[model samples]
Target: MIEVYTDAASKGNPGKSGIGIVIKAGKADVEYSFPIGTYSNHEAEFHAVIKALELCKVQYPKEILSFRTDSKIVVDTVEKNYTKNNNFLPLLERIQELSGHFPLFFIKWIPEKQNQRADRLAKEGIHK
Candidate 1:
């Protein structure tokens, strides 16, 4: 199983943002951080999940993925397979499309403290 921890940070509500993803597969682990220019916090969160899944599809295509995020909105939205916000529909669709590639895909909401690593990386991304 591949365990992925993801987070996103924005300097402002709809300002500069970045994404952080940490992937752990058995004894191996990898970290990625990238600046996403400008986006809202929710948008950044969705983007982070998308980026993590995209990386997994390339590196661990056939493996099951267990994704963890600190954003309740993201976890709940994905779990329900639906969202009321039209602005996020495209992002949700992309996530659903990406999830289809995995044998199993699961996302859980974690506390901010539990997602510290990803949080730090995301902050780093904001400055970059």
Candidate 2:
């Protein structure tokens, strides 16, 4: 199983945003922080998961995915596989599609302090 921790930070609502991801695949641990243009904080959180899945699709295709995030919106929406927010629909669908490539996928919600590494990386992205 691959363990992934992800986070996002936006300067403002629908403003400059980015995503941070930390993936642990066996002995190899990787981290990523990338700008995602302008999006709401919720949208950026969803994108972090999306980008992590996309990366795993190529790097760890057969591995099960276990993701951790501080964003309840991302965790709840992914767990239920549904969201009423229109802006989130596409992001949710993209996650579902990406998740299909793995044998199994799971996401858990954690407190913000528990996600500090990813949080710092996300903030780093915002300034870049």
Candidate 3:
């Protein structure tokens, strides 16, 4: 199974935002950061997962995917496969579509400290 850690940071609510992701698959480990224009922190979190899944789709293909994020909203929304928030609906749809490319996909919520690397990358991304 491939392990993925994702995080997002925003300078302010609906402000400049970015996403960070770390992927671990056997001996290959990679880190990624992206300045994703502007969005609220919650939206950024959702985008981080979407980005990670997209990356995995091209690189890992039929691999099993396990994702970790510091955002409970992302974890809950993905586990339940639903979100009532309108802003997240489209992003959620994209995530759902991308995840289906893998043999299996799952996400878990991690504490901030446990997600420090991705957190740092996300903070750095805001300025990029």
Candidate 4:
């Protein structure tokens, strides 16, 4: 099994954004950061999840994956504990579709401090 940590950040509420991700398998660790351009924090969060899934597809294809994020909205929506708004329906659909591609998947919400690696990458992405 693989454990993935992810986070996203924005300069403003709907300003320049970035995504950060950390993938861990046993003792090995991988990190990625990308500038996602102007978007709301919520959108950036969704983008981070999408990017994480894409990375997982390439790095750990055909394996069970467990993902962690600090975004309650994203974690709740994907976990089906909360309903997504009309504006986010499309993104939710895409996430759902992406989840189906994996043999096993899990999305869990953790404290922001616990996701510092990804959080730092996301902030770095915003500057780069």
Best model number under TM-score:
1
Clashes of 3: 0
TM-score of every model versus the real structure? 0.98, 0.97, 0.98, 0.94
lDDT of 2 at 10: 98
lDDT value, residue 88 of candidate 4? 74
Better of 3 and 4 by TM-score: 3
Candidate 2 per-residue lDDT, tens place, 1-128, comes to: 89999999999998999889999888988989999999999999999999999999999999999999999989999999899999999999999999999999999999999898899889888988
* Candidate 4 residue spans exceeding 4 A from truth: none
Model 3 gets an lDDT of 0.95
Q: Judged by lDDT against the true structure, how good is candidate 1?
A: 0.96
Question: Over the full model, what C-alpha lDDT does candidate 2 score relative to the true structure?
Answer: 0.93
lDDT of each: 0.96, 0.93, 0.95, 0.91
Q: For model 1, where is the 10-residue window of minimal lDDT?
A: 81-90
Tens-digit per-residue lDDT, 31-57, candidate 3: 999999999999999999999999999
TM-score, candidate number 1: 0.98
Instruction: Give the number of the best model, judged by lDDT.
Output: 1
**Candidate 4 TM-score over all chains jointly:** 0.94
List where candidate 1 sits over 4 angstroms from the true fold: none
Better of 2 and 3 by TM-score: 3
